[model samples]
Target: MKEILPRQIESLMNILGTIPGIGAKTAERISFHIITSKDNMVQKLIDVLYDIKENIKICSECGMISDTDPCHICLSPERNREILCVVEKPTDVITIEKTGEYNGLYHVLWGVISPLEGIGPSDINISKLIERIRNLGIKEVFFALDPDSEGETTMAFIASKLRDIEGLNITTIARGIPLGGNIEYSDMYTLSRAIRFRTRLNDNL
Candidate 1:
């Protein structure tokens, strides 16, 4: 068969296919749509991409991506200072925020500990969390990591490390989140219930 798509469009599709969930067919369709769409629409997308790259900054306190260093959540006086919610990624922070059941501070770990993958406690954002809990006088630490073996192992490891922290409580969201399910992909209702019914990490471990 004769070559259907131009080399440039093929290259674009290949680039798009690199995205996590975008398959080759979807990438090809998106490439075609981008080429066929209005020039201003394409320009707008390009501008927005540039804007994101230039304006987005990682929050120093919570590790969430935002336009500011500390992020609005970290700066907000209304948030509960005595509790902190720890999650595996910034997207999980956004997902939990949508549930509106939590008003505490957050700490994004960026990734979970996976021995097979060579990720360990030192590899993710653990030290800062420990420092925050101790220095900030946070009374409770709520974990909202993905419900999987890696998540469980990570939580247990962190809990063990935090055992020396006097007068501190460690907890995790309820099991309403299905096993192997991701907090970022969970429904708001399930996440809400999970937060509302959270249990002590010691009890589950």
Candidate 2:
């Protein structure tokens, strides 16, 4: 059958389809919307995309994506200096932030250590985390990573490094999150329970 849309419109649809969770049908609708919409709409989208590419950067201190150097969260003086919460990604930080149960600062690991994937302890942002803990006089750190094997391995590795820091405490959410589950998907209540009933990790780690 001959294509209903022009080459340009079909190209747009194909591009949109590549986005995760936006399948062919949805991409078709979106492509149709964009092409039929005013030229200003397309122009605005192009401008924003370019702006995102030009302006967004990773926060040097926390590894969170931001438009500024340190990011607003790190610059804020009200955040708790004594406690830090380590998460696997920037999205997980947002998930935990939604619970309104924690006042501590955050660190985004960017990725976990997966031997099969060739990701190691040095690959992610661990050195910066150690530097932060040592410089900030942090008392405790909470690990809010996922419940999968990779998460466990990452936690175990991080715990080992923190042990050398005398007088510092390491902890993780107790039991609310399910095995193989991700913190990004867990509800706020469950996350709150996990944070509230967190357990301490020691030499047994």
Candidates in order have lDDT scores of: 0.89, 0.88
Tell me the TM-score of model 2.
0.90
For candidate 2, give the lDDT.
0.88
> Whose TM-score is greatest here?
1
Residue-wise C-alpha lDDT for candidate 2, range 1-205, written one tens digit per residue? 1186788888888899999899999999897787678777888899999999999999999898899989988998999979999999999988888899898899999999899899999999999998998898999988898878888899998888778788888888778999988888898899999999888877557
Model 1 residue 161 CA deviation (Å) reads 1.8
For every candidate in turn, the CA RMSD to the true structure comes to 1.7, 2.1
Cα-based TM-score, every candidate: 0.93, 0.90
For candidate 2, the clash count comes to: 0
Tens-place lDDT digits, model 1, residues 1-205: 1177688888888899999999988998898788888776678888999999999999878889999888999999999999999999988988999998999999999999999999998999999888888888999999999889999999998888888888788899986898888788888898999999998876555
Deviation (Å) of 4 in candidate 2: 6.2
Off by over 4 Å in 1: 1-4, 203-205
